[model samples]
Target: MLATPPPYPSTIVTSTNHPEPPQITIKPVDRRRILASLAATITPFFSPHYPHLNSDQFPHIPVSFLPVANARGLFQMPPVRLSNRYFLVRAGESEFESLGIINTNPVAKTSVDNGLSTIGKKQTVKAALRLKEMGACDNSCWIWPSITQRAYQAAEIIAAVNGVNRSNIVPEYSFLDARGLGAYEGKALQSVSEIYASDLVSPDIKPPPINDGTPNESVADVFVRVTQLMSILETQYSEDTVIIVSPDSDNLTILQAGLVGLDLRRHSELAFEPGEVRFFDPSSIPTYKQPASALYKCPNPPSCK
Candidate 1:
């Protein structure tokens, strides 16, 4: 009479034996993060072992001085060549003062006689300017005067013109003597009839003759002394250099010697004018003139000893 009831079979439920599934939690990612971050940064620099441009490149620059017409590989110019160490300025003329010894009348020893004239001053300025034009001012330079005021004044003008500091000028007296030159100082061929003379000494004083001639320096003394000065300069500067002044033709002689590797022919005196300067070649030298009186050097002649 009533609805049929469904059958409930399979298994009976027990409360103590049944278990529930475990839950898992997850965190959300924030667009704006509050967490601290550690970021590493790097910077760059030049290496310490890099080479300098000037040192790496200067050797490739063309040599400023070229060879002369007569001499091969020797450099000579009116204006001196530029260099890092030295620039040589050859001063002509006798110094206005002497080293305690007077060559002229005592009355002629006044300041006017001892100093540079207006023309001489101008010449000195011109010489310096010429050197600058030739590029001698890139490094330290010197103004060297013979032991005389005239040379000193000329040197001063040159220093001022060349922009050389006063401290760079030095006084050198080595060219003043004839042990450096001896009896040849003031003697002159006063008359056209006068001939060149020599200071012949007794055989006792003269050294025995050698292939290069008796030990008397002849003109070689000037060459040796000049070479010595230049050697000193080479050590100090390692560049072309100028020695501002010297007495008579001493500076010229030295320069000529250094360039030619031989003695200079002293045809005339080197006079002072401020603007006047001479340049010499260091590599090529002239040959020395043999004197008629010089005895044959050796029995063997040793291949042009």
Candidate 2:
């Protein structure tokens, strides 16, 4: 019968109709876990901090006030003009993005604030595919911690699908977390939108009332933080391309930083949907050549003028 199927121990039967499976070697160490741990530890230290010096001594300068340069020196590159370009992507839909109810009020009768909940798998897979189609797979990504679980998972899926190494993903906290909703954090967007129309009109306006003494940050704060992060990225990744994942509010703030000259009041005018990807090239913006007179203003009253 079928030539006795060959001897069991001495010989193995061949399947000429089927191809042999590819060999997969497992590594002793999990390199992805190591890289993630390293990134988490070192990322916070890279956040740019604004000094609290006196305005008279050190006036608050706008990003446009900086000079432009290409070389590496003290005033080499412009603080706003990046030597390399990157993509800013809004994280995929969580409950918040989907317009679901979230209750920030701990004492409220009803609350649905599931901290760190991620989006559905279908959306995650779709987002990853889109990023790959856009050529994002060619570079590494920097993601925020709040959205890390979902974003990192998507990155992993993308890498696996493309046979890419998964170690390129890193965590970044420079981009501020989602706008603290305070009492509104856990409330449904529709309910909040209807209840607090005026305050929602401009995030910088009177912020939502505190929930249990927890204060939320204004849109202006987000603008300042985003600008600082942009400066840091421009300097650090001057010669490389990178991807950033952030929430809708923070992503809008980033676009505002690049488009509206970092004006806080103008931030409300910008809107970005979740999972949207936008490209920014700092070099496209014309550099502001500071007037010589403006450089050294007379500090001693009007006598010098």
Candidate 3:
């Protein structure tokens, strides 16, 4: 019948219906085993420090110029007027390592005293008070903290200053975890320098309190959360909404990358200190694209819940 199906070729007949599974290529992320090694690579190449540029100083640079990476995908929002929104302040001038080390683990405070810590908790409160004086106080105000203690504490201090009850503050814990690229949790909090060197590195990767075994949220993840949070705030109220964020340059860079819809490599470097506040009025410049929801997921796993 039909010339015996043209005498099926052995390789063609077997392979046609069932092709071999595509090879799964996983590039190794653990290139450096020591913190020093990773830090050496990143810090020198992209020096994480930059002086704050004032609007007057940069006459050529618009008060709101989109970083080149995000120019193409930028979206326009309403105009930003100073009377409408308050400054979105990052906390103090603390170094990344010092703050990271202080709040790396959760602390149990019996007093819950705002003025008790040298790590800038008191000043953070004052900063929020300043915001309140500027007419930014509202029950619907949003406050976000990364999963880290420093961020959480910093936000808590600000809420305290504003007299914003715990129930009123919106905690977007998902925005925590400064690790830029994606990787397993628990291990992600390690400093860039700590993770890459062989001799200095620990053999065991710490599992996150959230036990689902997923990597900590990526930089892309936070950007998406920030965008969604913004949307939710916008939908609920037509007026200006105040937001408090606790993130440094690395985290901000990722947020910038996500907002601009640019590839990871396209983002400009960023650095924000603790207690430092920078205001962004979405109305002032073109609104950047909010990242797709597919890239965002709760950083905490079920176990943590």
Best by lDDT: 2
Q: Whole-model lDDT for model 1 versus the true structure?
A: 0.44
TM, every model: 0.45, 0.56, 0.43
**Pairs of residues at least 3 apart in sequence or in different chains that clash in candidate 2:** 102-186, 102-187, 103-186, 104-186
Mind sharing the TM-score for model 1?
0.45
Lowest-sum lDDT 10-residue window in model 3: 68-77
RMSD of each: 25.6, 21.9, 23.5
lDDT of each: 0.44, 0.51, 0.46
Q: Point out the higher-scoring one by lDDT: 1 or 2.
A: 2
The ten-residue window of minimal lDDT in model 1 covers 36-45
lDDT of 3 by residue, 77-122 (tens): 2222122343456654333344343222222111133112465665
Query: Tens digit of lDDT per residue, candidate 2, span 1-305?
Result: 56754332343335668746644444477887676555444433443442332234434433233233345433222243555656666555654445575433223211233222355445555655776787764664543222344444444554565445656555554453455556566566665444335445664654467647534656555555666666666656656656665544444544445443644444444555555656765655656788786798776887885
Return the top candidate by TM-score: 2
Candidate rank order under TM-score = 2, 1, 3
Task: List where candidate 2 sits over 4 angstroms from the true fold.
Answer: 1-80, 96-99, 102-120, 139-148, 154-164, 191-203, 212-215, 258-263, 283-286, 292-305
